[model samples]
Target: MGCSKKKIKYELSKEFQFEAAHRLIKNYSGKCINYHGHMWRVIITLHGHELDEKDMLIDFNELKPLKKWIDKYLDHTTIIWENDPMLTFFKKNNQKYFITKKSPTSEHIGEIILDKAIELFDNQRIKVKYIEVKESNTSSVKVYSNKY
Candidate 1:
């Protein structure tokens, strides 16, 4: 009988911060419901087994596109729920913002990032392990993918 084999894996992480604004748009008891901004921090982790001809699980340079995408969409922009009426006003005022179906809380933002990351990395040949989002140094959340 042949023995099963285990493959070694390599992981790569990229972390960055961006400024954005959001309001809970809910009947909650906190400042999240009011307009505010944060220097949000995000970390992206990728896992892979096989390396390309370049002997790398993934080329770090390939992450430039992700950085550009984040800067274009999330940096210094307001994030809002799709159903939030503020979205219409912001659009009409020609402001930059990202609309999501989920609430823009720190934890939910982590979920949103993970959801988009799967599609964003479809052609990268690497599986996303998790995404960690931090609203502040003392507050953070991580969303893991089942494939991880």
Candidate 2:
């Protein structure tokens, strides 16, 4: 007889957007001097250890709320690097916001996004084994389990 239960691994990713401004110090942008926002994209990956009765590792619907969290907080918010002098000025402006101790590169932002996604799976046994962040469609960085 075939085994009724199977242990299957499943992974799913969701994309979200945020708007924020940042400047790279000593970088070559003559007029990056002014604040600018990006149509930032965040991709969150979720992993699951066991398959349910449907032989599914995870239900896509279950991961939807993670997008909601990102949209409400990080979306359309100015993300300031911890060391930037602009931090104080943005605070003074009292605009929508978020703060980062590191430069707001896609990798750093990816970690923040990954951390939040994992929180949703807290009661589950599965882990977010990996994360990949893209600053532009052509460029990206990843963090893996070994780094954890």
- Which candidate's TM-score is highest? 1
Runs of candidate 2 with Cα error greater than 4 angstroms are 1-8, 26-34, 122-124, 145-148
Ten consecutive residues with minimal summed lDDT in candidate 2? Answer: 24-33
Local distance difference test values of all predictions, in order: 0.83, 0.68
In order, how many clashes per candidate?
0, 0
lDDT score for residue 62 of model 2: 78
Quickly count the clashes in candidate 1.
0
lDDT of 1 by residue, 1-148 (tens): 6333245677889887899999996567776788899999999898876667898867877767767777988999999989888898999999999998878888788887787777777445578899999988999899998787
Candidate 2 achieves a global lDDT of: 0.68
Cα lDDT tens digits for candidate 2, 1-148: 6543345556766666666666654343556545676777666665666666776656777777777877777777877677778778878988777888776766677778777766775445466766676656787777654323
